[model samples]
Target: MDDLGVTVSAGSYRSTDPEAVHFPHRWSDEGVAVQAAFTGAHLLHLSAAGCVLNDVYREAQRLGVAVAGVRVSATGDFDTDTWVSRGITYSVEVDSPAGADDVAGVLEAVDQVAEIPRAIRAGATVRRVPAAGQE
Candidate 1:
């Protein structure tokens, strides 16, 4: 089993600062669109996109294919009425010296094993643990 962890702290809604926390890895919108910044639905799509991009390159290397560049766009629809993610769609463009069939094969292999999408598709349970000092 593969395990990964990340922590996102709440940011001040009234702050002028870009990020709520000073952590190096924190993502901010320059204090604009704070609500969207913290929305889990948006972050979920981003995570899936990031996973696909990383896996593309990794799989390319493993397949001995030289990829000049890669771009992935992922979008998910959220049903506010039901508070659920309805579906997700993604498109990938890869610049490579390998033949089209080879590149396609690589992409398929990556899709099969990319972590985030797999977890989401498999319905992984999220267990929230309170902070150490929390009651």
Candidate 2:
């Protein structure tokens, strides 16, 4: 779907010292709750992983597949000195009564719908711009 694209409401309110930021995100498309923790990189990864898992489970349910026996696990491999992720190993194991082929098909479909997996497989480019008086 997403004919109109996803809609979300997010805002960040930080204190005067700017030591920390309180960020909140809401799903405006369906009045759902989406949360984000304003911590560092590690916490951000956990939040992103949790969002991906929820997205996968929701898609499976919409396709009439049972995900009660599903297990999702993820780990991060990163170098702090370089401040980059070497890789993220994530997997999903489904224990449905369906046959092996069926389970595989369902997982494939889920992966197709989840955004994070697609982004991971096909890299994205980012260009940073300096703010008005920063440079």
Candidate 3:
């Protein structure tokens, strides 16, 4: 039921599902570590939150901080009947030796670079075009 798809110029594609379309990519590729989703709003929510959390973890690691665990959940006021999300909220929990100050910084950092989360929070325009010689 997803109408959107992604084309990565050549190597691989992560398209709408339940087709589960995935292409083989070399383990050495940067994308090997970054998975994409085309599963609509909820998947977007998860991806956005995850992206922020990943960044936080990366920065924490660089700072020599140990984060034992991290969990993120998204809740929203969405109208399925209207096919729109009215409001969304993200909740995060982290088990770490980093104090409240550091955790607060992580949260702030999430605000700065969670692209997908920001996309959901601020709606976007999406268009679909026919592939290659299709009509």
Q: Return the lDDT, model 1, position 2.
A: 15
Q: Count the backbone clashes (under 3 Å) in each candidate.
A: 0, 0, 0
Higher-scoring candidate on lDDT, 1 or 3: 1
Alpha-carbon deviation at 25 in model 1, angstroms = 13
- The 10-residue segment of model 3 with minimum total lDDT is 5-14
Compare the candidates by TM-score and give the number of the best one. 1
Candidate 1 per-residue lDDT, tens place, 1-135, comes to 111212222222222345533322222222212212445766787677667766876788898887766656677776667867776666677777789999999899999999999999988898989889995
Stretches of candidate 3 off by over 4 Å are 1-39, 62-64
Which regions of candidate 1 fall more than 4 Å away from where they truly are? 1-38
Per-model TM against the reference: 0.70, 0.52, 0.61
Off by over 4 Å in 2: 1-41, 120-135
Measured by C-alpha RMSD in angstroms, how accurate is candidate 3?
Answer: 8.9
Model 2, global lDDT:
0.49
In lDDT terms, which candidate is top? 1
Once model 3 is optimally superposed onto the true structure by TM-score, how far is the C-alpha of residue 104 displaced, in angstroms? 1.2
Model 1: which residue pairs collide?
A: none
Whole-model Cα lDDT of every candidate shown, in order: 0.63, 0.49, 0.54
